[model samples]
Target: MPFLTSPVLPEGTLSRRPQPDIPAAAGLLLRPWRPEDAPAVHAAFQDPVLHQWHVRSSESEEEAAGWIEGWRSEWARECDAQWAVVHADTGELRGRAALREIRLRDGVAEVAYWTVARARGQGVARHATDALVRWAFQEIGFNRLELMHATANEASCRVATKTGFAVEGTRRRALLHPDGWHDMHLHARLRGD
Candidate 1:
């Protein structure tokens, strides 16, 4: 039996993960994570709000370092990209943004983000997400990108909408958490949308 071949992408289309720092609006910057950021990452995960939505917390700096290392491995494998969202002037780690479930054959990926407690109420998530989506579409050549969040997470919903990801639909009881099953809202944006 013959199998259909995957379409060929243009040469030099994100063959490797990009390493350049991306500057976004509102004085935010997206850059690769470093080991020194572990402390900040650990602290950010301690926020009760983050735990409520994300359902996981880093118990120690070491665990946070491991998480950052995992992102490096994913980048090397060309399967995911993670960046630390920081303030350009102060170089403070405000949050994180990532593109996961990257399917090069299908030209699709999913975006996820979280902001630290101090960064809450600011537009860090929105700016970082918008920058990442632009990079994924223009530089990585992804034709479609997706963002999903717990249906009850209004803040995340706002970020998704601000970045131009339209709500596609809902997945009933799709995510399991310590509290219970959660319905997730699916949002997406196409290459030109």
Candidate 2:
């Protein structure tokens, strides 16, 4: 079958190239997740805040390792991109940043991130998000990116706004958390923004 329009990005646009290590402000680097980071991944999920927002926890190191492998597989298939936000000098895992739900034909993806407790006040999430926002538009050829957070997640809303994602309004009860459904705030940025 023939299509009426060309894909916004070719299918292999991401998988054909190496996932670059993105540099961010505040001495952070967004690097690809590695198998060795399983322990840290497990530890991070243990944080109450992370657990609450993600609605899932790593039950064991093996489970965390599987998660890491899953991320790698996604990258290879160009389905999603996940990065470990780490300290540039010490290489400590500070957080995670990702482009989830990528649609090459539409040139869109949803941006996501989380900062560990140790990195909360130091602007890790903002820096990582800014870096990803730039990379997605400038380098990867995405036309639009969406960032959504539970209406109750104020910090995430701030990061989205600071990074230039304008609020598009709320998605009532879009995300379900441990406590119940949450009204989600949907924010978006265009490549031209």
Residue range 81-135, candidate 2, lDDT tens digits: 9999999999999999999999999999999998888888788999999999999
RMSD of each: 1.8, 1.0
**Best candidate, lDDT-wise?**
2
The model with the greatest TM-score is 2
For residue 84, model 1's alpha carbon misses the true position, in angstroms, by: 0.1
Model 1 C-alpha lDDT per residue in residues 23-59, reported as the tens digit of each score: 9989999999999999999999889898899878899
Candidate 2 has a TM-score of 0.97
Residue pairs in candidate 1 whose N, alpha carbon or C atoms collide under 3 angstroms: none
Each model's backbone clash number: 0, 0
Model 2 RMSD to the real structure? Answer: 1.0
